[model samples]
Target: MTAAVRPPYRVGIVGCGAISRNHLEAFAALPEAVVVAVCDVDADRARSTAERWGIEHAYGSVEELLAAGVDVVSVCTPHPTHEAVVLASAAAGAHVLCEKPIATDLAAAERMVAACDAAGVRLGVLFQRRFWPAAQRLRAAVDDGTLGRPILGHASVLLHREPEYFSSAAWRGTWASDGGGVLMTQAIHYIDLLQWLMGEAVEVHGHIGTFRHAIEVEDSATAVLKFASGAMATLSASTAASPSLGISIRITGETGATAELSEFPEGTDGRVTIWARGGAIESEQVHPADVDPNVDLAAINGQLIPHHTAQVRDFVSALSANDGTGREPAITGSDATAALRILLAVYESSRTGSPVRLNQTATQEALA
Candidate 1:
């Protein structure tokens, strides 16, 4: 393959908010990126964030931002607006970096993907947790067969939210805006990791309930995932836990080699807490901070961004190089469809009391 030309990347922001700050910071860290414009439905919020970030223009809609001459966009809007913004971005000839839970359903996700594919623009989803250093090492090990055949894994998040949290926003728990409560919004990171490591889940059986928070959706969820590779996984996620808890993931293999990863506050930003046994590093132990987690808007070469920055780089590279790999490793719009499919299956299985197959089409209540 021939090397692609390199230059500073011009970027735009759509739906500026808390998570959007991370995107702004990551982009700022990259010398190749210049964040010039932003768009949001709430003009005040857009104006406020744009001013704070020193962005030159604030757009009232996705179309306006596209007209501002941006090369790519970071989508931080609610789940419901994902398709609209992504399609607009593609049509505008700008690449996209969308937030998690791509869309509420597989159909919307497929539409977003198809739009980008037809436009010949790249669509990247933000799964920044993958950039964690320890995760990199662990995944590398798994890919190299050092962990032997994968058996099963467990991922859980002990996070909590108050009753006021649900009341804080109209879309907080609604199936329309935020998608499917804890599973789609918060546990998605863990879900992505589970799929990333163990491969696609062939079946999902879940038990869901609203144990604490009063919302339009389930506050707690536990699922059993059976992968095509015969590897199994159990996911436990809740917004009802006390004192907010971090995330933990454990991967067990047939060779007795096991790897465990975790997240902690004030630490482990781009790193994974690791534990391995009965393998090459059985006797060795490492901390997540050993690799250092940086969300502080710092790029390696002052020319590339960190965290979601990789997605941005891949987007630009894909546009300029026509390299298929540029878009593959990054999350495509359609990939979110697959994630939504699994989530909907879990919900369906929980409600109907049966194992839901991945190949099965989503039922109408899949949205509810």
Candidate 2:
């Protein structure tokens, strides 16, 4: 007798944006998954994306995509629109993997999480950077006490974006559409990574300004965070750096050990740039030397396909093992909310000129 082979999960992609390509490519690479359909408000784009990817179906709305059937949905819509798509997908009993920052506000995120839980569906938020080798090593170090009792952390995300970057998309730099600027859009990834390694944030003090960009949202932001485990961290991010410096995160442990992950030239794999313990210190350069500094943003985003593929693979594995003994997604909706909560608190603190505490009431009040 031969063992049975399971059929691949039917995956549906919502939103045919630049980031959607990442999701599509990620799913296309997984043999255990097949993108059966695609949907977008712009029916033409959806049709084109489907045709380009050789998918069989495309629709103008989520309802049509759900009607066509799917086992999983990858939500690639804007930050503010994620909640609706996630809720609808969960209602249709399909597991959802969403782009980061879960939603524009914490309340929406909580509702989406609750809906997924009630529907008995899994909800994953994409923080693909978490899948980076260097990120994994740092997380392992924290978990195994290699960096015993992390006492301090820092993330610097200084990158350049031409004014055209925002002007190109109607929703790019608007609070109403995109949710926020640097802190909400770009830094949220590093914030998620920071909170993931530092445990939980208890308080936040921050400031924001539209230093250079001619947009309604702030182009720059700075914040300090206190974690529940008595660890402290600082975050400074901006789209204002000329010629684009890359992003870096550093962690210092009470055991007198320190490690740093640096992603230089932007949109590249980060490496453990510095690791110091006792009398030993080491550094490794991961990205290519002589790389162009002014690569197009779309090209930069394309570099993240590998990490996206890694996370999508995990999502498929979890769904495939639905026999009650499967591992959950690494970045669940609840796990993602932690970073959103911290960043929202930063926004509130910056507005009110006071340190904001992290709690349900505080979060609700901040959004209110």
Candidate 3:
């Protein structure tokens, strides 16, 4: 007797918003995955999206889609709604791929991770930049001790957001909906990369304020982080800049090893520079011929599709390797929570006007 051949993983998307289009495009590019269904609160939107994507089924609710039996569910809904959908998907015995900032609230994020654990399903989060070649090389250097004794790191995510940017989306700049302004929504990808490159943030001293935008959340924020590896980092994020500076990051070590990268909209390509001992330096300028030099915000997805598709392929491969023996995905639910924990700590520090410590108990003394 021969073993049975498993079919490609079936994926159902729960939101038909703008970001879902990126997810749909990524799925379409992969042969190991299929967009079996799509769901949205708006029936017309769901049907239209399904028609546009050539998907077979469209539903007005996640329940209907889950009943249709998808092997994986992509939760592209609002940030606050992720917990409920993830819980439901886990209950249905389907793996979940959640968007960034897993949940708006810490308690909710904890519950979502726990529920997935109990239900025995894999949860992968979309932090696509980690799959970038430059980021991988930097991480490898840090892990292999090439960047010995991490000393300092600087990460900046500066972009421009007009009034229409916030007014266009109901949850664009709200703490309750989008989590936080520049740090949570815009700079999160870099924040995740920073933490992954350095180590866990053990202490955070931060401040946040809405300087330019009229929205409820802060449009600009800054933080100083102390990592578990004894590394110190400074981070700044703002959306008030006139032109998008893209992401700039530099990590320096005590042994003359440095890794720096810069990405700007005006530049033809993003650049990464790495240097180690003995005066040897290497750099790569990544300018894909297909991407334009003046890539607009909407068109940015065209450049990111490869990274997103790579993540999806990794997720599908992880699922295939799971022979009912509880193997973890490349990016697990807890792994996604790591960055969220630091961001939450930053918010807490800003609110209390004091430094915040994470994953550790501190001795408190009563004021005289």
Candidate 4:
């Protein structure tokens, strides 16, 4: 007789913060899963989220949850602590879905990936923009050769923030933990998008500086990139811009197909447009973001929330198939390594007043 199928999957959450809420919503919506545990240094924060989510298990430390029973763990903690959490969870035999940047440093990012490999667990970093509908349309255009090879693509995330945001979070503006100010924390989505569209960058030259906020990392940065395809791109990110901040990426293919996302897919209440040659293309492919009500204004933030659920689902799928295994690690922990490598190069170039070269994907072993 065939064995009965198990229900969805079980999940445990680490960190309780602005982004964790979105992860919770995604977990709640899935029929195949249960949020079996919650962890946070703040007892109240962890317990409160557990109570609200109807989860009976709550722990003050992620180490405790690892000791408890958890099939998977979400590393939604502070930027500085991601590496440790992911490694510990991977060691505990739980696949992990870590937030972006993987870690504050390229080294930490590599360690997380390597540890996962040694532990035989998958590590998935969140880069939800890959699933955006408008993004899909653009990707289609590029793939179809409508953009004529995309000679260049440009993307930027510029948002204004009050000073309070910098000082409010204990580690917000510091170099040791918060990583780079805006580029690492806020605009990383666009940075990942740039790589997604243009392929890995071969070299980069940039200008980085801090202003408008009291952060050790650059509040602003701009760079010129040379891709393996011989294509070029201009990338910029900042958190000090005035209000009415814009999030967009314009790609110019050798064939002259241009794709533009004027509004941030996360909170875009406006329409997205695709222009080719000189005419506007009809139809917007973006689906409803499907964000959870738990997050304010899910209509906008829904994209991230919804995609993360899909991300977790992918995580579970991979775990289920090991050794000819379930799903080959959906998004390898190494993807984060690549992104972080480029980010560090950008910073290095900005710091040295020189350009950095990245002719190929950085291997985890090379990093080792």
Candidate 5:
């Protein structure tokens, strides 16, 4: 007997917002995937996106998109509404690739994971920065002990968001919808990568404030993280800066080895410096960030498309096997949940002016 051949995977995208363009572009570049349908609360937006992308179908709601059927669904909706869309997609027998933050709260994040697990479909998050070349190299060094016994780590995210940026979207800059502020929305990529390269966060102490933006959430925030591996790290994120410093992360090990990486605005170019004990530290520019500012779509796509495409490829590959052997996705629901746990702690710490300790459990209590 021979195994049946699988058909090309069908993809449906929920929420036709600006971020959806990157998802569409990434999927369009992959032959294994097809964008059959798209849905947004705005019917006109969905119709326009469907026409622009040459998608086969367009719907006004996620319900309609799910009913039409797709092998994989990308939840591009707001951070708060991700849980509902993910639950429905998983129940519909579709694997899900959700955008960052996972959900507004830990309970909702837990529920999304449970629903997908019960449905027996794969779930992945859109933390594309993990796929960056410099990031990958650093991760390899950490795993291989090139950076022996990680002891210290730090990551900073400074981005400029005009008042109109948040005010334009009613959901933005709200605890109920956008989650926390810069930490949850803008800096989550670095936060996820920091935890990924360093280790799990066991304790967090931080402070938050809405310095620039007149929104409810904190535009400027900072946190200190203590990893389970005994590594101490600090995080700072702000949308209040005049010029975006992009993301800067540095990890120092007990052996005096260090990895420093930074990315600039609009995803132009980044520098990586790696130093191993007893050897000359070498640095080089990676990930071509040289992009035109005026050409917004091209610039965004230039950097995002490749990274997003890489993640999508990994997700598709994970879907190809059921042996439960070596096909695990690079980023899973549990991983995203863990990242959300840290963000929640940062918020809780800021709210209460104390440190929050995470118990040794996969589903740790984050909201308390």
Candidate 6:
């Protein structure tokens, strides 16, 4: 007897924006998956993306893409629009791999999760930084007890965004469209990583301000998190740094072992920059000659293709496997929601001038 071969999974991508290229390139790298269609409100952009990627179909709406038939749908739209795309995909019996933050608000996030659960389709979220080799090592240390229960953690995301970056996109800094600013758009990745290593966050006290950018949302923000395991973490993120400092997350264990992961020059491969265990300290030997402040979206997306491909490959494998040995995606809709909850809490805490407790029923009305 021989095992039967399965056909390649059909993929459809919605929203042919700056991030969509990463998803397209990722699927292109996987033989088990083939992108069949793409959709965008801007029909020309969708057709252009399809032509550039050698995809067969391009449409102007999610409904048309769903009608064309797809096994998996990649939601790459802006923050507020994720819900409609995900819901439509799930309703059409397609598995969804949505871009980060899940949704701009908890209410929408919850509905998306519930819809997928009810439809019996998998819902994966893209927190591709988790695929970084350095990030995996830090997670392993905490899991294998090398980090001794991760008592404290800190994540700093100091980078520069040009004024033109926001001006080029109408929704870049608005609370309604892009969600929040530095914390929502940029720091959410590290916040996800921090919470993954530390544990479930129960509360947060935070403040936000627009120091440099003239946008409606905060260009700088700070937050303190209390985890379920009694671990504490502090997060400070800004896009106003002159030369772009890059991102670093440091963790200190109960046993005093410490490790730091650094992603210099932004969007590049992250390195375990610091490690101290058993009175021995190790540090990264090589460092970037200069950090580029002018690194743009296209370059960053190009740099992140490898990580995105890793996650997309995993997602396709999970869908392909049917012999009872299949694994769920590294970041599920529910797993991604944890980070969104924490960030939303930070917004609430900032507005109320007090620590906000993590509650399932809290709506995002306060964020507005």
| lDDT by candidate, in order shown | 0.74, 0.88, 0.79, 0.74, 0.82, 0.88
Q: What TM-score would every model get versus the actual structure?
A: 0.85, 0.94, 0.90, 0.87, 0.91, 0.94
Tens-digit lDDT track for model 3 on 1-368?
11111348889999998788879988888888899999998889999999998999999999999999898999998889899899999889888999887887778888998888788788888888888887887778777888766689998877777788788878788877787888887777788888888777778999988888898988888999887767889999888876566668889976768888666652222357445455877765533455443445566666677777778888777777776443566677786787888888788999999998787432232101
Clashing pairs in 3: none
Clash list (residue pairs), candidate 4: 8-32, 9-32, 148-255, 150-253, 150-254, 321-325, 321-326, 322-325, 322-326
Off by over 4 Å in 5: 1-5, 274-276, 283-302, 323-326, 361-368
Error at 293, model 4, angstroms: 22
- Report the lDDT of model 4 for residue 80: 88
On a 0 to 1 TM-score scale, where does candidate 1 land against the true structure? 0.85
Candidate 3 shows a clash count of: 0
Considering summed lDDT, which 10 consecutive residues are worst modelled in model 4?
291-300
Error of 4 at 64 (Å): 0.8
Query: Candidate 2 — worst ten consecutive residues by lDDT sum?
Result: 359-368
**Deviation from truth (RMSD, Å), model 6:** 4.6
- Please state the error at residue 134 of candidate 4 in Å: 1.0
List model 2 lDDT by residue over 184-280, tens digit each. Answer: 8889999999988888788899999997988888899999998877789999999998877788999998787999999887888888999998789
Candidate 1 regions exceeding 4 Å error are 1-6, 270-274, 279-306, 317-320, 323-329, 360-368
What candidate 2 gets wrong by more than 4 Å, as runs, is 1-7, 284-289, 360-368
Superposition error at 174 for model 4 (Å): 1.0
Model 5 poorest ten-residue lDDT run: 286-295
Report clashes for each candidate as comma-separated counts.
3, 0, 0, 9, 2, 0
Model 6 compared with the native: what TM-score?
A: 0.94
